[model samples]
Target: MTVGFVAFHYPRPEDFDDFVARVHQIAGVLRSVPGCLSADCWITTDGDDAVVSTGQWESDAAFAASFAAVAAADVDVTFDERERRPRQIIKLASR
Candidate 1:
């Protein structure tokens, strides 16, 4: 089955542009991995500043492999939300 993940990132207003840039870079890295169907970023034009990133894989195993490759590559992205809050991650699969 096709699989994917979505993550919601909340960075202070001052860090918004930098955070978006880093997420785009990560998406670029994800696109290089085999079986990665898509990798992209999104943001809202209004409301509380937030960012979203998504990655889709051809299969469950492919999704896992993509994660492994991203981890192994160690994309240099370091921006933490205030008080070290973690980003929200949601897994996805086609029914």
Candidate 2:
């Protein structure tokens, strides 16, 4: 029963690099947490301001544990997002 989250994000034009950097930093932190299977970040070749991140876990319990770990580590995951179309989140479950 693995679970995951995929997020679509848009950075302010001038904030793209900084936003992506923060995404990578957070992903790195999550990867070290127990039960985190994979954490990845990506940017589109045709889109300069778009960033995508995915976090996968071993199970629902693992997902919860990872969130707790992230909170305990005091990792700031927020970014300067685009005003018009901020961030979108999607939850996933393994079939």
On residues 1-95, what C-alpha lDDT tens digit does candidate 2 reach at each position? 89999998887777778778878878887888889999999987885557899999999988888777777776667544442376898999999
Instruction: Note the residue pairs that clash in candidate 1.
Output: none
Candidate 1 residue-wise lDDT, 18-81, digit = tens: 7888888889888888899999999967895778999999998878877777778768556545
Off by over 4 Å in 1: 77-85
lDDT of each: 0.82, 0.81
Q: Which one wins on lDDT?
A: 1
The segments of candidate 2 whose C-alpha lies over 4 angstroms from its true place after superposition are 79-84
